[model samples]
Target: MQKKILLSYIVIILLAVGISATTFWNTGYNYIEDENNEHYIRQAELIANAFELTRFDSANDFSSFTKSYADKYNTRITVIDLDGEVLSDSEVEEQLENHGDREEVLDALRGEKASVTRYSETLGTDYFYYAIPVASESFTGVLRIATPFHEISNFNNSVKYSIIRAIIVCVIIAFLAAF
Candidate 1:
């Protein structure tokens, strides 16, 4: 009976250790993903701010201006006035209501770096947005850039798959050692 109790306790301890280790590794993966997202947001905001600073104002239409800028920068760019009016977009000029209401746009209009993520109903996927303020002599506005979240999602999924593979390997090793 004492030997049976000892074996049971040993098994419980090993199981608890395995569970704790898996939990710890999963937490680390989440931290890495969060950091990657933050890095991307900062980079996008910086790109938007730089574009806003050097944007040409002499163009008759801001759409053309945005297109040219996007071509040059290899990223999407949108300029919005203080009131959330879309002044320029690299893609389309459709009447988008209250652009400033978005957290990133609002922060940019208020002279701060801001970022947000959301699911796009039209695109059927998630997206990330980064924005910063455009300061000029006369007017203050916002410059926003966006990228699809698929890139990050892919990376995260790869990481998760690797973690699972590692756990399976670990379990196999443990079983072999026990045997």
Candidate 2:
């Protein structure tokens, strides 16, 4: 009877620890991703506002302006006109294809805030992209900001590893207490 009671208590404790760890693992990843999304949205809006205030003489001028902001933020920035033409890219020097068909760009062109994570063929890397519509006196289009997806993945993986370690510690503690 005593052994049965002890075993039940150990099971309960282990179950509790497992549940808590699972919750933390999920919540941590969501919180990190949300924070990253918010950060990029705010940055994109700010850049769009700033862009509305300036008039670029040519694509080179536009690229120069975006390059400065990209360097400052350590992210890529691209401007796409209403017709889907790539007006300027902070990182790309050559003429690029139209972005009209991209889901995020389409959403932004329709005056909606948009975000997506995907592989970029041009940059040869995965990125988290955030875009917003911009309408200035001289320019009207979408301004997009992107950061490498690895950054967010690294943070999420760190959280997952920490949770796994915690679970292992808890299991060991539970076993010791059971004995």
Candidate 3:
């Protein structure tokens, strides 16, 4: 029957649309994630190099330096000494717990560049973190920079919604064409 043929055609079209949409969504998500990783890594390296070039006379000087950079970049910055002491944080004034056990920090301490996305207990939020080893005449430590995870989530949500809308439009078009 014509009705049966039309129904089959519509079903095939819907399946194709669904498959394509899924592939697009996954590819977009991965691309965004990779871009973010590269961006953060470059930022961390730049900040670390800058830190290595500077020598702060006191803790206040160190804190002030990091605070300025954090404000400029709209991010959280922390300097942790080799002994795991929190020398300074752009966001926190009080001395917080040691970061030696942190995965990214640990990797940085071993002379490796590292990055991770996780919840920060101190800040009580999820963040994308990047860390690098930095050394200066007056300081030797790890420099870490973090940006809120919500930025990535917001972009991903927009892409997902757009894809969903596109699938809806395609399904409607396919149905009409098949009929």
lDDT of 2 by residue, 1-179 (tens): 98998989988997899788878777877888899889888988888888888887777778887899999888899999999999889999899999999889999999999999999999899999998998877788999999989987888888788879878987888888788
Scored by lDDT, the top model is: 2
Q: Encode model 3's per-residue lDDT on 1-179: one tens digit a residue.
A: 98888878987897899889889888988998898788778877888888888988999978988998898877889999887788999999988999999999999899888999999898888999998889998988899999889987887798889889988988888777776
Query: Whole-model lDDT for model 3 versus the true structure?
Result: 0.88
- The CA lDDT of each predicted structure is 0.71, 0.89, 0.88
- Residues 40-140, model 1: lDDT tens digits: 66666565555545635553346775787677656567778888987776765575556867878877777788878887553577777778787655346
Q: Of the pair 1 and 2, which is ahead by lDDT?
A: 2
RMSD of 1: 3.8
Where model 1 places Cα greater than 4 Å from the true spot, the runs are 1-17, 58-75, 91-95, 136-139
How far out, in Å, is residue 158 in model 2? 1.5
State the lDDT at 51 in candidate 1: 55
